[model samples]
Target: MNEEELGTDLKKRIKEVLSGSLHIRHVDTGSCNGCDFEMSTLSNPIYDISRFGVSFVPSPRQADMLMVTGGVTSNLEKALRITYEATPKPKMVLAIGACACGGGVFGETYANAGGIDPFVPVYVYVPGCPPRPQALIQGILLALDQYEEVLKRGE
Candidate 1:
């Protein structure tokens, strides 16, 4: 299906399967910090993502989703694995921007590990040098939708 259709379906499924709020833990593996700015915009006056029941938390243990930015770097690979393990099961991993999705221009460098998928499963990928806030929101919703599907399928 098209992105538009997928987005609508995600919204519907999220509402159907989830109730109340969800806490997200933001992880910055390695990047130019461009994606971080777009993420901050999500909570700003214009978008105000908190109204949608998503809040950012500091710890992975307290989070339902892992909002990952940047490509994984060699130094942080172990930390990333530990964080993923800390996150409770039935979790969703949201890979934001080109860097996190596939390492962007820094692909497979000596210091860059490319993507988070090899270390942790990525449920939704938002592709852009810095994806717009709308895209970020869509990615979050998509993650929720996928999480709901996983729960329903008992997997």
Candidate 2:
């Protein structure tokens, strides 16, 4: 599909995913807070992801999607896994930023082991060293597509 059509399709799928009960929990593995900053903008009046039927939760256990950012640090691996496990079935993971996707500039460093995919099954990858808010929103919409697929397969 063309870009516009694809975006429309994604928005439809996101609506479907939100038709059911779903909430997102954000995790900052070891980012420089740039990704976090962009994510925070999603809640601002302009973007207002809530109007799109998405909301961020505080606890992982209460979340249906895990929005993770930053390179995965060895110390945070266990916590990340625990958080993923805490999320119930039919969960989705969104790896935002170059750091979360492939460790960005921190890859192979002693501090960071790798990206978030190794720690959890990432459903969507938003690649940017520090992604813009619009890009992050697109990633979120893509994740809702995955979420809809899972629901379709009756998983």
Candidate 3:
């Protein structure tokens, strides 16, 4: 299916799976802002993920998913943990960008914690120096699929 078809299908799936909406909280650990910018693009008219019942929320307490970007920095490790704990149960965590997946070029530095996996359970990983908006959407869809499975297992 083309992107339009996919968007329509994704909208339906999100509604059925997430009880109408999926609110995301974005966390930036320590990379450049490229991935963050790409994620923000989903709210633009062209992508308009809001129509799919997907929105970026300001607080983890209000989020259904955590779209984490950048490598885990020492300064942000505690914050990440707190954010994860603050989110309600059955939440999905998506590690976006290469930096979040494996720390990118700044891998395991004195100030960087390598990847988010060491800190929290990641449900999806979208790898790239900075993945495009399309990839980010794909990652979200993947996370939704996993969420569906988790629900089915009553987890």
Best candidate per TM-score, number? Answer: 3
Q: Per-residue CA lDDT of candidate 1, range 60-152, in tens?
A: 999888888889999989888999999988888999999898889999888998988888888999999999887887777667768877989
Whichever of 1 and 3 has more lDDT, that candidate is 3
Residues 66-151 of candidate 3 have per-residue lDDT tens digits of 99989998898998999999999999999999999998988888999889999999999999878988888788888889999999
Compute each candidate's TM-score over C-alphas: 0.89, 0.87, 0.94
Clashes of each: 0, 0, 0
lDDT of 2 at 143: 77
After superposition, candidate 1 runs with Cα above 4 Å error: 1-15
What lDDT, from 0 to 1, does candidate 1 have? Answer: 0.82
Give the alpha carbon lDDT tens digit for every residue of 1-155 in model 2.
Answer: 23554435445666566664448899888889988988898888977767656689999888888989889888888889999999989898999899988878888687897688766888988998788877776776777777777888998
Task: Indicate whether candidate 1 or candidate 2 has the larger TM-score.
Answer: 1
Which clashing pairs does model 3 show?
none
- Relative to the true structure, candidate 3 has a C-alpha RMSD (angstroms) of 1.5
Write down the lDDT of every candidate, Cα atoms only. 0.82, 0.80, 0.89
Worst 10 residues of 2 by lDDT: 1-10
Candidate 2's TM-score reads 0.87
